[model samples]
Target: MTPSRELWVVLETLHDVTYFTPEARAANESAGLRGFWRGYVATRAAPLGAAGLGLVTAVFHNFAPSFLARSLPSVWEKVSPERALAARLEGAVAALRAHLPEPPARANELLRRAMDGLCWDGRPLGAANAVLPWPDEPTAALWHAATALREHRGDGHVAVLVSEGVSGLEAHVLRDAADGSRELIMPNRGWTDEQWTDAERNLWARGLLDGGGLTDEGNRLREHIEHRTDALATYDLTEAEFAELDGQLRPAARVLVPGAVPHPNPVGTPRP
Candidate 1:
C-alpha cells in the first residue's frame, strides 16, 4: 500500500473507537439515543446537523435507506445534533485513554497539519467535520482530526463508487465477494437476502462475478476503485511525514484490532 493508504488504515482504527467501543455506545444511550443502530446513525451523522434521510443516504452512500430511516430525524428528535457530537467525542476520548498510550505531541501536530491541507470539495462529511471546533484535550483533538481525515477519504471513496456506477448495495456485494465476507457484510449493511441475490445477478450481467468469486473483470474494477480512492485520499504530507504519522499510530491500531475494532468489519477497514 502507498503511504497515504497505510495512514488511512491506522487512522481509521483511531477514529472508529467512537463507533465500536463500549464507552461510545454508553454515551450514546445516555444521551437518549436508545439502540445501537440509532446511536450509530446519530453520532456519525451528527456532524451534518440534523441531516434528512436523502442527504444522509447520498453522502453515507452504503447503508440501506430503509435502515437509515429507522433512526434518522427521529434520532435528531431524541437528541440534538450538538449533543450527539459531544457524546461521541466524549466516548472516543474515554476509549482512547483506556486503550492507547498517550500520543506523541508531534503526532497530533502532524494530524492537524494533514487536516489543514484537506481539500473539501465534494467531500460533504469531511467538510462538515473539518469545520467543527477542535477539542481542548489532546486526545480529543487527535480523534477529531482523525475523524475528519477518515471521512474525507470516505467521501472520496463514495465518489469513486458513484463514478463506477456502483450503488451502495452493489458496492457491498462486490466487496464481500472479493474479500470472502458476505455473511458479515450483508446483515451489517441491512441488505436483504433477496437484495443481495439481485445484486449478484446484476454483477453477473456486468460479468463481474461467477460462482467461485470475482471474475477477472470484477477484480479489475475493484482494484481501480481502491486505487482511485487512494489517489483522492492522498494528502499534502511528505513521504517522511506519512512515515512518522504511521509509526506513531500503528501501535495503537494494533492494540485496537480484534479488541475494540473487529477484523472483517462491516466498515471494510483491515487490521493495521
Candidate 2:
C-alpha cells in the first residue's frame, strides 16, 4: 500500500479517541465487564470466551494471560454474558451522552456517512456492530461509530498478520521484540518457558530477530503491517475528508485522553 498521511491521521486519531472515551471506560468498569466477559466465558458450553476475544486477542496478545484471566476469569453461573455486556454498553453510552450531547445526530452523520462509501463485503462485523441499536444520544452514537471503525481496521490487521504468517503467540513474541521489552509480555501471555522459546525460535528462523533482538528487517515488517492496516482502514475517505475527520475528533480526544491514563499503551500507538 502506498503511504498515506490521511490514513494515519484518521486511523490513529479515531483509535486514540475510543481509548480515551471516558464514557465507555466508565460503563465497562461500572458494569464490571471484566467479570461479565469472564463470566460469559465461564458460562459458555465450550469456554469460547476463554478462547480469548477472537481477533482482539492478537491486539492485546502481548499482555500476560494472567491479567486477562484475572479480569475476565471463569465465573459462569453468576451472570449471562449477554446481560452483562448490555449493561456495560448502556451505562457507557449514557456517559457518552453526558460528555457530548447528541452524539448520534452530528458525530454519526459525519462519520457514518463517510463509512457508507466503503465496501463491507467479506469483513466480519465485530462486537461493535453486533446490533444496530443506535442510541438517541449523540455521544453514544459517536462511541458506536468509533468502535465499528476501529474493529474494521482491527479485522483487516488480523488478515494482514495471517497472510504474513504470524500466529497469535508468535505475533505476541515478535511484537515484544520490536518494543525492546522482555519483561512485559512473557509472563502475561501464560506461556511456559518452553512455549516462549519455541516462539522465538520460529521468529529467528523467519529472520525477523537475532541475538540482539528485532533485526532491521523485522522492524520494517512490523511498520509495514501497521501502515497497511491504517491505509486499509481509510479506504472510504479522500485525503481531505480523512483530515476533516481527524480534525473533528482531535479536540474531543484532547479533552478525554488526559483523564484516561494508565491505559495499556500498547506498542502500536504513538504517545499522544
Candidate 3:
C-alpha cells in the first residue's frame, strides 16, 4: 500500500472502533438514539450540528437516501446534536481505554500538528470535526484526532468520486467489483437489487465494468481516484513525520484489525 493509504488504514481503524464497540452502542442508546443505524447516523452527523437530510446526504456522499431518511431528522428529535456528539466521544474514549489504557501521547501530538491550519474548503465534515474542542483525556484526544483526519481524507475521496462522474451507488458498485465484496457492501449501503443492477448496467455502458468485475479502464479510474485522494489527504506532514506517526499507531491497529474493526465490512477498510 502507499504511505497515505497505509496511514488511512490505521487511522480509520482507530476512528471506527467507536461504531462497533458495545460501549458506543450503549452510550448512543442512553442518549436516546437507539439501534445501530440510528447511532451510526447520529454520531457521525452530530459533528455537523443538527445537519439536515440534504446536507448529510451531500457530505456523506454514499448510503441510499431512503436509508438515511430512516434515522436522520427523526434521530434529532430523540437526541439533540450536542448530546449525540458527547455520546460518541464518550463511547469512543471508553472503547479505546479498554484496549489501550495508556494513550499514545506522541501520536496525539503529531496528529494535532497535522490537522492544525488544515484547509477546510470543500471538506465540511473534516472542518467541523477539526474545530471541536479537544477532549481533556489523552485517549479521547487520540480518537478525536483520528476522527478528524479520517474525515478529512473521506471528504477528499468524495470529491474524487464526484469528479470521476461516479454516483454514490456507482462508487460502491465499482468498489465491490474491485474488492470482490459485493455481498457485504450492497446490503450494508441499503441499495436495492434493482438499484445495484442499474448501477452495474451504467458502469457496463461506460466500459468500467463487465460480468461483476471492473474492466481495465475501471481499474485505472479507481487507482487514479485513490491516488488523488492520497494526495489530497497528505496535508503538510513531511515524510519523516508520517513515518513517525505510522510507527506510533501501527501497533494499536495490529491489535484492532479483524477484532475491533472487521475485514470485509461496510466501511471498505481493508485489513492492513
Write down the lDDT of every candidate, Cα atoms only: 0.88, 0.54, 0.87
Name the candidate, 1 or 2, with the larger TM-score value. Answer: 1
Q: Indicate the TM-score of model 2.
A: 0.71
Residues 1-272 of candidate 1 have per-residue lDDT tens digits of: 98888998998999988888898888888899877788888989999999999999999888888889899778788899999999999989988888875865688889988888878999999999999998878899989988999999999999999999999899888988877688887787788999889999999999999998899999999999999999998777898888888888898789988888877676778889
Error of 3 at 272 (Å): 3.1
Candidate 3's C-alpha lDDT?
0.87
Determine which window of 10 residues in candidate 3 has minimal summed lDDT.
263-272
Q: Model 2 segments beyond 4 Å from truth?
A: 1-76, 94-106, 125-131, 186-189, 261-269
Query: If both were scored by lDDT, which would come out higher, candidate 2 or candidate 3?
Result: 3
Clashing pairs in 2: 64-188, 64-189, 65-188, 102-138, 103-138, 103-139, 104-138
The lDDT, on a scale of 0 to 1, for candidate 2 is: 0.54
Clashes found in each candidate (C-alpha, N, C closer than 3 A): 0, 7, 0
Estimate the TM-score of every prediction: 0.97, 0.71, 0.96
User: Where does the lowest 10-residue lDDT sum fall in candidate 2?
Assistant: 39-48
> How does candidate 3 fare on TM-score?
0.96
lDDT of 2 by residue, 4-89 (tens): 34434333543443334555455445545443334223222111232344433444434445545554434323435554555445
